[model samples]
Target: MKLIFLGPPGAGKGTIASRISKDLNIPHISTGDLFRKAIKNQTELGKKVQQIIESGDLVPDALTVALVKERLNNPDVENGYILDGFPRTIKQADSLESFSKIDNVINFVISDEQVIQRLSGRRMCKNCGEGYHIENMKPQKEGICDKCGEELIIRPDDTPEAIKNRLAVYYESTAPLIDYYKEKGLLLDIDGAQEVGKVAEATSKAISK
Candidate 1:
C-alpha cells in the first residue's frame, strides 16, 4: 500500500498501523524504530545518529531522509509498507516523493484536549515497563501493574504541560503535511476519538478501497 500514518501523539497511529499491517501482510516501518535499530547495529549512519542523539540535538533532516532512503531499499518493503513516522515536514514529503510513490496518507484527527487527556492518563509500570491507562485500560488494582504487581507511575513526558508542548511542536512541524497530502488527493481522514477497534475498522475500510 505504501501508506503513511499521521496524527498527534496518543492518537493511536501506531496501534492502528500495526493492526492494518498485519491484516494486509505489510511491514509497519517507523522511523523511530529505524533509528534505534541503526544505533543498536552500530552502522555507519547509526554512529552519526548516536553522536547526534547523545548531544541532545534533533536529528537533521538530511540524515533522517538518508536513513529512510536506506530502509526503503530493503526487500521486505518491495510489496508495501505502512510508514508510521516519516516525512514529518514538507521537505521530507518531497524527498519521499522523489524516491517512492505513496498510495495514501491516513491523517487521524483528534482535538488537542483529547490528546492531552489521553496522554496524561497514561501510566507505566516501574518494574516491567508495561503500559496502562488510568481510564481506558485500568489495572485490577489502582496505581499498580496487573502483570508484575509493580507501581505504575506517570511518565514525565505524559504530563499535561509536556503533552501541550508536544502538540505545539507537531503543529509547527508535521501538521502541514496533512494539507500537503490533501492537496495531492492522497489524504484520508479518520476520527481518532473512537474506540481502538472502531478506529482500526475505519482505517481498514479506508485503505481497502
Candidate 2:
C-alpha cells in the first residue's frame, strides 16, 4: 500500500504508520529517520542537511524531495511504502506525484490540549533514549528506564510552549494538505484521541476502503 500519514507532532503519526506498515509488509519511510541515517553515515546530502539545521533553517523543498526520492528507490519500496513526514507542502505533494502515486493519506486529528497533555507527559531515557508516557505508558521505576535503569528526562521540546509553537507552525504550513488530499479523495481522517490500538484499527479500516 502506498500510504502517506499526516499529523502534527505528538499526534501519533509515527506509531500508526509503523503499525500499518508492519501489517501490510511495507517499508515505513519517515523523513526524520532518513535525515538521521544520512547524517549518521555522513553522506553528501547529510552534510548539507546538517548545515541547514545548524543554521536554524528549514530544509529546502528541493533537498527534502531529493532525499525522499532517493529513499523511494530502495528495493524494499518496490511494492510500496508508508511515508510519514515528507510532503509537508503543496509543492512537495505535487513533486511526489511525478515519481509515485499515493493510494491513501491518513490524517490523524487531535486537539491542541490533547497534544500538550500527550507530549508534556512524555519522558525519554537520557542514556538509552527509551520513551515513557507518564499517564499512558509509565516506566516501572518512578523516572527510570526499564531496560537501562537510567533516569528519564522530559525533552525541552516536549514542553507546552514548544508544543504550542510547533502546532502553530504545523497549522500554518501543513493544514492545507488536508484539503488538497481530500479533493483527490485520498484523505482518511482518524480520531487520534482514541487509544493507540483503536486508532490503528480505524486506520486499517480506512485503508481497506
- Segments of candidate 1 deviating more than 4 angstroms: none
**How accurate locally, in lDDT, is each candidate?**
0.94, 0.92
Worst 10 residues of 1 by lDDT: 155-164
**Model 1 lDDT at residue 35:** 94
lDDT of 1 by residue, 1-209 (tens): 89999999999999999999999988999989999999999999999999999999998888999999999999998889999888898899999999999999999999988998899999999999999999999999999899999899989899888888999999999999999999999999999999999999999999889
Give the Cα RMSD of candidate 1.
Answer: 0.8
The global Cα lDDT (0 to 1) of model 1 is 0.94
Candidate 2: pairs in clash: none
Report the lDDT tens digits of candidate 2 across residue range 1-209: 89999988989999988888889999999999988988888999999998899899999999999999999988999778999987899999999999999999999999988999999999999998999999999999899999999999999899888988999989988999999999999999999999999999999998887
Model 2 ranges with Cα > 4 A deviation: none
Q: On a 0 to 100 scale, what is the lDDT of residue 66 in model 2?
A: 90
TM-score of predicted model 2?
A: 0.95
